[model samples]
Target: MKVVIAPDSFKGSITATDAATAIAEGWASVDPAAEIVRRPMADGGEGTVDAFAAAVADAKRMPITVDGPAGASVRTSWLLLPPTEDAPAGTAVIDLASTSGIELMDRLRPWEADTTGFGQAIAAALEHGVSRLVLGIGSSASTDGGTGLLRALGARFLDDGGAPVAAGARGVLAIASVDMSGLRPPPETFVLTDVTNPLTGPRGTAAVFGPQKGLTEPSDIESVDDALLRLADLLGLDAQHPGTGAAGGVGGALVAWGARLTPGAQEVAELLDLAATIEGADVVVTGEGSYDGQSGDGKVPSFVAGLAASAGARAALVAGRITADADIGLFAGVASLTEIAGSAEAALAEPARHLRQAGAALARSLSD
Candidate 1:
């Protein structure tokens, strides 16, 4: 049988590459004649660069250091894909998680963290003469409404005195004007994200996502939300635009810079050519750290299921933990690390081993 193993990272346990490797190994154990095709997935988040680097041919990593989520410096890199027919000069892939994610914060700086580092990385890629840019804006650490990023890209967020304001959300209220004459943007830019929030108001960035970024107080949320609204007005952007609120309003800022926002899952799938890879497969296997109610919403498993269905293949899953409310009917076979290892701690301690065991079990059951 031909099988495709495509999974997202188990988040703190195993990466998508390692997970696919383990599952493939286990599947091979059950069916020694099986042909396994591995295609790990990422939804415009932390693993985006690695996913592309692994799937795309001749992808190089360009390293650079920039400001981190707080005030510290971080060593990060962006992907440089070999020149394609569509993009003669090649494409630059940048992810906000590496430069300005919450993982970089020791103590959350709700009001002071910024995306300057992310912007700086983009600037570096631009300087390298990339013809196209793909930006993954997820796991952000601030609610700055992309001011810090725009600043790094040559836009000036100046106060009434014509001086730049602070680095993070603190500068939101101090913004008096925006000058974009010096900004040099790419000819083609795509903002990849799964978020669908608008730029301001109740379901917007500051109100819905700010608390997770350290805006715990109601006053802080209100202040940041209002500040974002003011920013939208200054930039002449639609505050109600879908996905404008992703990554703490970086989505809207990117749109202001001529980016087109698209669903990250679909975009990544297309980039990886997942549909073509599964065309002749008998089964497509996918998983994540947890399978819950939210797993159906543009996540790896659901995305793989759809692809497998389109290709006339059955889809299976091997998740770390499956919540009681999870809808398992979407997959032809389902396995969980918890069920294999007998406990969550055991599963977490030896994720690869348990994941392999789960894969073997699924293969055996399918062969029955």
Candidate 2:
């Protein structure tokens, strides 16, 4: 049987490529004669760079210094794909999550974190003369409504007192006017995002995601909401644009800067040529750290499964934890589903073993 393995990162347990490899290995052990193709996938979130780099040739890593989530100096990395003779000379892929990801901050200091480093990274990429920038916006820690990132790129946020506020969620509320004099124009920019939340309101940035960023109680919620409103008014932005709440309002800011916002999985899948990869496979396996209702909303695993079904291939999921009520049927040709372990701790403690087990179960089901 021709089998394709394409899985997202197992969160803290494994990389997407490694997850694919483990699944492939398990399938190989079960059916030694199986023809297996491995394609790692990401949702343009945390592992976007690694997934794209592994799939496409000529993508290289470039290291640069940027601010950490806590306003400290941190050395982070971004991907640099040197242009071919036929392509433009200055095109780069950037994952904003790499610099401002929630995972990058200390849990105790989430309130103090910001996205300044992400903006700095963008500036650095621009300095390299990159004409086209593809930025993945996910896993953010800041709820400053993207003001922090804008500030880093030379946009200044001044209070009514004409004093500069700090760069965090708390700082967003004090904005009286924005000074864009220091901003440099980029040729073109695209922001790949996985969410559709608006900038402000019940379904807005702070309400939907602030709690996850270490925000506690109704007061913290009110604080972030107020801050976002202030920033929106100061920047003359519509507070209700779809996807404006993405990455804590970074989506709206990018839109203000004329960046195109597309589904994260769709953009990454097209970039990786995922549809073409699935065409020849008899069965395809795709998954993530967790699979739930959110997976149906333009996530990587669902994207891969959709492609597999379109190509007349059976798809399966191998996730670390599968929520009981998740609609697995959305993955139309997904013939099998397997959770890595019964719990998170077990999965993390022995990811390789659990992956092999999941793979074996899938192999048996497919062969049956």
Candidate 3:
């Protein structure tokens, strides 16, 4: 029997690479002779670079330091995929969640967090002369509408007095003019995300995602929304385009820079050549930190399940937590680390252990 293990990072606990390895180990324990292929995956978020590093033999990490969401220096690296037929110079994969993401902040800098680091990393990759860019724009820390990133790329957000404004949402609100003469031109950029929100309305960046970044009062959300609208106007771009509201308006900002917004899971799958591996597998195992209603909506697990179905493979799932809203019927086998560990706390305490058990459980289902 052949089995392919591909899972996303169990956020705050285990990485996708480790999770895939652990699951493979457990599956091997049950079926010692089964062929196992571990292909760790990410949907343009926290583990995106790791995913590429694990999938491609020639992929390299180019390290660089940049400003974090809270204005601190952050050491991070972008993945550089070796030159391909389609991309002669190579491709750079940069994920926002690891650089200027919310996790980098000690506390929510709702009004002050920015994407400067993300932009800096991208700038470094550009300097390296990468021909194409795959940007994961999830888990942003601020709603600055990508101003911090733009600033790092040489686009100036000036005040009425012609001086640069402060960074973050605060700076976005005070913007009185724009300068793009010094901005760098991005080449064939693709922004990966599942979001389809507009930039500045009820379903826009501030209105929907601001509270998560600490915006509470209606007035606060309204103010940020207005600021984003103003920024869009200045950029002469449509604010209501789908996905413009992603990553606290980073999506919209990238759109202003000529980025093509694409679904994260699908894009990553193609880059990893995931479907080809599942083509003849007997069982395909996939996972994520949480399997809930949202998981079915273009998440790694759901997308993997679809591929498994197409290949006539039995899809199995092992999740950190499988919520009641998730449809377990989508998979031939399902295991929850929370249930196996007897508690959510215990599951997170030793995720690798539970992931192993989850793998064993799915392996048992194969014979039954």
TM-score of candidate 3 on Cα atoms, chains taken together: 0.98
The candidate that wins on TM-score is 3
Clash pairs for candidate 3: none
Cα RMSD for candidate 1?
Answer: 1.5
Model 1, range 1-368, lDDT digits (tens) per residue? 89999998887688888898899889899998998988988888778888888889899999999999797999989999999888899999999999998888888898789999999999999999999998889889999999888989999898889998898899987888989998876569988898999989999999999988888899989988988898899999999999999999999999999999998888989988999999999999999999999889888789889999999999999999999999988899999898889998999999999888988988998754
Clashing residue pairs in candidate 1, if any?
A: none
User: Which stretches of candidate 1 lie above 4 Å from their native place?
Assistant: none
Expressed as tens digits, the lDDT of each residue in 1-368 for candidate 3 is 99999999998898899999999988888988899999999888888889889999889999899899999999889999999888899999999988999889899989889999999999999999999999998788899999999989999999999999999999988999999999999999988998989998999989999999998899999999998998999998899999999999999889999899999999999999999988889999999999999899999999999999999999999998999888988798999999999999999999999899888888877944
TM-scores for all candidates: the values are 0.96, 0.93, 0.98
**Ranking of predictions according to lDDT:** 3, 1, 2
Per-residue lDDT tens digits of candidate 2, residues 36-111?
8887887767777888778888787779888888877778787877775534765677777778888777673545
> What's the TM for model 1?
0.96
Best by lDDT: 3
User: Against the true structure, what is every candidate's RMSD?
Assistant: 1.5, 2.3, 1.0
Candidate-wise lDDT, in order? 0.90, 0.80, 0.92
lDDT of model 2, residue 118:
88
